[model samples]
Target: MQAMQQQRQSAAPGALAAFARFVLCGGGVGVASSFAVAGLSSWMPWALANALITVVSTLLATELHARFTFGAGGRATWRQHGQSAGSAAAAYGVTCVAMFALQRFVEAPGAVVEQVVYLSASALAGVARFAVLRLVVFARNRSEGAATARPVCVPEGHVLTPAGAAGFCRAA
Candidate 1:
């Protein structure tokens, strides 16, 4: 039981640390973007304003996640950016739907109400986004962590290899 606990702790240490960094980096940008979206909404339709802010903030957050949150050790690649963008689009939809529901229930909802709804939606989406980013977008970061031990793929016909290890071999 102790050994199992230790292994679980070792595996989760990176995830817990990464989640803290993710909250700091992504939450900061989200707060800023919320204000920006609210401000921009005054000049244009709220949806348009939200779309603009979402794009810019998504870019900034992806960069921050790569450098600080996920410990990618460098700038995010185009592929990572694209994948992050996909997840952000879903988050955007979530926020928009929440806002729409607010509008439906309350006639001319006050700024405070709108912000409350928007931020609530954002928080919900953020959790899922963190999962997707950690498990898929920035998976390499976890695999590269020193605390984690990854199985090595042995070459075919290596003397040290067990018969069960054949599953790791590439199909010729």
Candidate 2:
């Protein structure tokens, strides 16, 4: 029971770390996408502007997310980037479609109503994006060779246990 408790305690930090990374990356992407849509919509059709902004922002976000969020430091390949972009695009498309349908029927009398609709749609889309990103784009698979690779260590203290020796081996 003590061992199990210790194990759970050890795992808690990892889970928190991952969640922190996700929040940071998600916030960055959200800001980028929001700014892009608002800025571009002034010069172009709202739909086109939204799509363009989403794609560009998604690509940039994916790179940051893969490196910072998923601990996939050295594995940010074009394929992985593409996969993230695809997931973001799908999420964006769904949001746009829903927003359009709602706006068409919901007859907003004032600017506030329109704003609420757009904001709500964007929030829903963000939820979808995170789900796809966590589950599909950056799926955690123990069998994946990358996950099994030993982490590099920074010099700290004298090696004592077998685990310490393995860490030293990795560092060396």
Candidate 3:
């Protein structure tokens, strides 16, 4: 029981550390992608530029999140990549909506204004993406952990196992 409590406590601190790494990896890719989109927009439609950059950046960021940010213990699996892409799609929608609002409300919004709006929207979506990736995409397998638990002999002819686990005891 005490070990279980300590394990829970240690997990809490890992979340904070993961968030910091998420920011560093994801944020770094996002910033670079934002600039890339801004530059590409000069040659093509802004939406096209955004779509291209989003795809590329999502791939890069997903890899980073799986390996470093979320500590998934290896390269991202296909399922994880698919889930991350789903979240990225939502984030793309958010940025698009933000840019559309900026255009609708402000006439001839300058490059700086566009960049600011895009970055702000991206940041908001990034927070949500972090949660989804941490909780759903790369989360540790609870059932596997439970399966490895050692059974404890608590009393005469009685054995106990960790929560969500099964144990066997001798019939007395």
User: For residues 71-98, what per-residue lDDT tens digits would candidate 3 score against the true structure?
Assistant: 6655778898899999999999999999
Q: What TM-score quantifies how close candidate 3 is to the native fold?
A: 0.77
Which residue segments of model 1 deviate by more than 4 Å?
A: 1-13, 144-172
TM-score for each of the candidates: 0.76, 0.66, 0.77
Candidate 2 segments whose C-alpha is farther than 4 A from its true place: 1-16, 108-115, 140-172
TM-score sort, best first: 3, 1, 2
**Tens-digit per-residue lDDT, 28-145, candidate 2:** 6776666667678789987898888777777777777676666554446677778777777777777678667867888764455645666566667766776676677666531364
CA shift at 115, candidate 1, in angstroms? 0.9
Q: Which ten residues in a row have the lowest lDDT in candidate 3?
A: 163-172
Best by lDDT: 1
The ten-residue window of minimal lDDT in model 2 covers 6-15
Give the clashing residue pairs of candidate 3, or none: none
Q: What digit string (tens of lDDT, one per residue) describes model 1 on residues 84-153?
A: 9999999999999999999999999988988889999999999999999999998865566654655556
> Candidate 2 — what's its lDDT?
0.66
